[model samples]
Target: MRIAIFGKQFDPAFDEYCLALFRHLSLTGAGICIYKPFYEFVSGIPSIKLNPDSVFKDHADLPECDMLFSIGGDGTFLDAVTIVRDRPIPIVGINSGRLGFLADVSKDELPSALNDIFEGHYKVRQLDLLKLDTHIPAFGELDFALNEFAVAKRDSSSMITIHANLNGDYLNSYWADGLIIATATGSTAYSLSVGGPIMHPASKNLIINPIAPHNLTVRPLVVPNDFDLTLRVESRGGSYLVSLDSRSCILEESIELKIRKADFSVSVIERNGKTFYSTLRSKLMWGADRRN
Candidate 1:
């Protein structure tokens, strides 16, 4: 079996766990490849010397691997998605930081996780992604977001007016700092922070959440994933920022944005005992109360 590891620069606190992961994987005799940047980051560390089968700097250099391991936090996991774009390879996340929603596995669980993978004690789950459409491409050919697609005012103080339409029918005009269209995978991300309801990962729904809306009555709405949504933003600065997970770009107010479910979905590796509900309870501290 072949596994590709990807990560970005992380705090020194996570260096040991990262090194341990590499050492354990290398010992398994599985074909190992590391992203060039991550390999360079650990080059100076005496404890972590990796003679990987391949060192990849870009997606084109990524060889066919059975699985890809994303090291670091959720941001690194999102970055891993960009490389595994439209690929069938299942990506697993190894958390080396706090609050790892996407990077579900902890350093303590690394050995068991690997054991599960090697012993075929894992399943591949498909995650839905939101695709962006615009006249001029902002995020290149890979315009899909695993978490969400958000549009917000560029300036800090001002709220933007986002005209939204669902299936060519007027939905509502949002007067807020920003708006988020999140997949079920993203319901726990930016949307949840702003009072959006959490949807199960298998749900065929999308969340339309407003960020600090002028009217309190305008709450987050859930819609079918199949509907095509259109958005036009008007900001005082004449520009707005649109983010696809960790990637973002500024766009002119005149640019119209369209969002729909991506034709493809990313596969995530779910080891035994790591279910959606279990992750929610552990990560979000769901139902944890001293009084209870």
Candidate 2:
């Protein structure tokens, strides 16, 4: 079987496991291809020097394989999706950081993880993505966001006015730093940091979370998957910053963004031993309070 590797960075502290994992795969006789970004970051590690005709930035050059292994933290895993956007290959995260929600495997668990995987001990799950469309069609340059697409004020000085409408009906204009429209997969990410409720990956709900709203009554809104959100931003601080994971774009107030579920979804490699709620409890320290 063949497995491609993708990562943003490889930590020096985890070099041994990195090396071990590669060696283990070689011993297990799996063919490997490395992402160009990861190849530059961890060059000369005695790992197979796979040639990368394409880097993550170029997007078109990413090689295909049966499955892609993402090495590093959760951020790297998210970065992996941009490379594997709309592809059918299952992406698995091998964690090399603290409190990894997306990256599941710890360094110590590498060997057994591979054992289970090689022994057909894995589950391929489908994750729904929120795609932001400019609807301009010609500007294919900026379109989809696998995790989320957000528009926020650039500075802390002023509360930006974001007029939001649901399915063509006026909902409310949010006067806040910005708003986050997160997928169920992203509910625990930036959205959670700003008071959005954590949602299971399978939930058919989209979260419209306000970032530092000025009005106390403006709480995070959980809407239907069918809810079409229209966002119009008027920020005095600067042009609103729209982020698709790490990629950012600036938009004038005149531009309107329409968000809804995309036509496609991403496939993830998940195993049964690790449950989403358990990861939340372990990573976020949920219900960890102890009575002394």
Candidate number of the best lDDT = 1
Model 1 residue runs over 4 Å out of place are 290-292
Model 1 over residues 69-113: C-alpha lDDT tens digits?
Answer: 998888899999999988999999988878888899988888888
Task: Superpose all Cα atoms of candidate 2 onto the true structure and report the RMSD in Å to 1 decimal.
Answer: 2.7
Per-residue C-alpha lDDT of model 2 across residues 1-292, encoded as one tens digit per residue:
8888887666677888887877777787787777765777777665544443334444576566788888888788887877787879898899887778779888888888888888888889998877777745522644666566788887768889999999999999998888989888888889989988988998998889999899989998888877899988898754778887667877777788888888878898777687897788788778887861
lDDT of 1: 0.91
Clashing pairs in 2: none
| lDDT, model 2 | 0.80
Q: Pick the candidate with the highest TM-score.
A: 1
Q: Candidate 2: which stretches are off by over 4 Å? A: 46-58, 135-142, 287-292
Error of 2 at 122 (Å): 1.4
